[model samples]
Target: MTIRCAVIGLGMGRGHAKAYSEHKDCQLVAVADIDAARRERAAKEWNCATYTTAEELLEKAKADVVSIATPNALHRPLTLAALASGAHVLCEKPIAMTAAEGREMVAAAKTAGRRLMINLSYRFSPQSQVLKNLVDGGALGKVYAGRTVWLRRRGIPGLGGWFTDKKLSGGGPLIDLGVHRLDLALWLMGHPKSTWVMAGAWNHLGSRIGASQGKSYSVEDLAMAMIRFEDGSMLEVEAGWAANIKEGELMETRLLGTEGGLVQKNVGEGYDFQAEVFQERNGTQLDLSPHGPFPECKSAYHHFVEAIRDGKPHTATGEDGVAVQELLDAIYLSAAEGRPVAMGATTTKTGAGTG
Candidate 1:
């Protein structure tokens, strides 16, 4: 049983197309992009049919699996259309612009009786998988707190385009880069229910640079937040696209537990990562690191395909995406209101000072 796959939005969708083309149980049937050049290039490179719009691809491709790699605002509509077309979906992350929209997408997938997975790509790293295994196996015994951060010296993407526009891309690094790290930390800690958040955001550098270059930029360049969970656990989150930091790029997630602590951080300002675990053994300090002979961590695309084919559970479900979206919404609201915002309930009474 071969799964026919189609990809929309050729920028990151190209990676989706390549993964499908290489998977043994999948076929890259079609691709779509508004840009004619991108469509033509994808057709030539993948030798697959191309469409001018997602609507046309869904109508004609007859694909069993669809990948939605469009802008943040378009995620809901495109995902609804794909699910309506009877194809399981693998949507790019942040899921949607709002938690409400993410919930709607999840409901639509349920009504359609099709799989809806979000492309949280960071979870597929070998280091991440190993740490996840350790956490699940109780190696980190009752994790209580964590700090997740992703910062770049000067790495604002598409400065004047949809990425910098709040309406199109949701927000800046908090939604783009922070979501990945936040999800990783939460997943490692067994996904505690968040209770409230206090955050602050700034748009100093991005706005100034955009004004000087005669470009429109309306999102914050940096955002920081402290979140509380129902189980008395807490998390500190920080994300920035432009900062005065010396490192060109920095990424790290550290979890503190009753028995031990674990950290996964990028190596040498690059994508390469290293993980370490610290604990006390017989009243002596001991630090452990994962060496060679790690398990195979498949790409998100391949994992989605295998889950659909084998009737197995896949990571990063639509519900997981919504959980992250809820946190994103709360953080932004807290930043805008300059106070702590409570979750789960409708009323937003002040809790702690945003200091």
Candidate 2:
């Protein structure tokens, strides 16, 4: 079956459109964005119909699958609307501002009998893919703990825009950058049930930078958290948008297990990443970083398209997104109250203390 795909929010949605257009099982049917320039650009570049709003696209565009790439706040409504329009949805990270909203989206997809996937792009990376295989293949036996970090130096996105606004973006790097690492860690750890979270958020840099730029900023610049899982495993997560970091950008994920340990980190503060597995044999520490080229990993977009075409389950589902969001909400809450928050804890729509 040829999956007709439409993408909303032209900024990162354009990446979705490109992937869909390139997939053999999918066709780019339409694109939507609030900005006229983005709409025009997408229409010209993808040679597809364009709409000023996602509502219009959902109403008129004949799409089998819709990619929701709008702001953090729009994910739930757009996803629900797309599902109601008989279209599967591939939404961006942090599925919604809160777990309650995330649940609604997941329920909507179930009722619509359509698939709902999240754009967890890192899962598709070659290094991450290899690490996940190792974990699944029992190389990393009894995984008990992990650490995930994504830190940036002076990398706050759009100070005055929705990104810096608490109402729109939910939170700062924790919800934006940290979500990716957190989800990656959880997935590699076999999606363990989270138990609780203790976290702290700081605005040491964002507030000052925003004031200097005459921009509105009411979110944290950095966040760190410790999460406990049901199986007695724990995860430490750290994310920062602007901070006094040595590297321009740093991303790392390390997993400790009974049999071995695995690590995936950026190379020399660059975008390129390398993965290594550690094992002890004959009382000797062995480092295994594959020497040859990695197998071509499938793109998350292509995976969504194939799932829709074949009526199969996608790797990153709405449930996975919800789990990630719940963790994020708990982290923010713990930061707000200076106390650990339990899993399945309820929070208001705007998410834990936006400030």
Candidate 3:
């Protein structure tokens, strides 16, 4: 039973369309993008119908599911629209501007009786899966700390385009890039309750460089935070577009536990990643790195299809997205308020604090 799917926002939506087309149980029936050239190109490549707007595409495609690779700000409205239009949705990460928005989208999904999956693509990586297995198997006993980094020497995108604009991206690299590692760490740590956060965000890197492209680079180009969990676990997160780093670090997540440790690092400062596991063997230091799989987000694409077909729970649920968003909100608040931000307790009304 092919799950007919539509891909919207053709920048990365093209990849989503191709993944759907390749899946035997899924069919890529249509593509949509506001950019006419991009829309036509994707339609021709995928050999499917195309629309210039998601509303129009949703009206005509009648797909069972839709993959929304739109900008971060558009996530909630588009997901709600798709669910309301009788289609399940797979929206990209950093689900919405606020946890409140994320929760609203989740509620809408429930009201519409539809599935909502956030594309935290890193969680579905084969290396991530294997490391998870080892951790679940107790090879990494009593996980205590994890760290994730997505630094680039000087790789800010869309110049003045939407990437830097807070109106569109909500924040900056923290939401855009760090969110992936945040999800990966929490997922690996069995979703520990985020207790509090101490963080800082800096825009010194991008603005100091020069005038950027179409959008205002008013947000931070770098953000660093420390997250405390209920179980006494901790995660250190660092991400940025432009930073004073010697190495052009792409992405890496490391887990340190009582029994063992696991780390996946970019081998050549790229998507080609290498992972290592450290275990004790009668006092001998053991560092192991098997031939890790290449970069592929298809697993997530396929998961959405099977989830819709089987009516089963999707891997990255709206609740998970909300949790991450809640943490992100806390981080930004911490940076702005110049104090620790409490996650579980802090809210708009309460005089609660995270520090």
Highest-scoring model, lDDT: 1
The list of candidate 3 runs beyond 4 A from truth reads 210-215, 291-298, 345-355
**Which runs in model 1 stand beyond 4 Å of their true positions?**
345-355
Best by TM-score: 1
Tens digits of per-residue lDDT for model 1, 1-355: 9999999998888899999999999999999999999999998998999999999999999999999998889999999999999999999998999989988898899899988899989989887899999998888788888999999999999889999999999999999999999988988887887898999999999898889889898999999999999899899999999988999999999999988899999999999999999988899988999886888999999999998888888778888888888999999999999999998663222111110
lDDT of 1 at 294: 87
Off by over 4 Å in 2: 345-355
Worst 10 residues of 3 by lDDT: 346-355
- The TM-score, computed over Cα atoms with residue i paired to residue i, of candidate 1 is 0.96
**lDDT per residue, candidate 3, 141-212, as tens digits?**
998999988998898877787887889989988998899888888788878777889999988868866464
lDDT of model number 2: 0.88
Would you list the clashing residue pairs of candidate 2?
none
Report clashes for each candidate as comma-separated counts. 0, 0, 7
Instruction: Find the number of clashing residue pairs for candidate 1.
Output: 0
For model 1, name the residue pairs that clash: none
For model 3, state the Cα shift of residue 41 in Å: 0.3
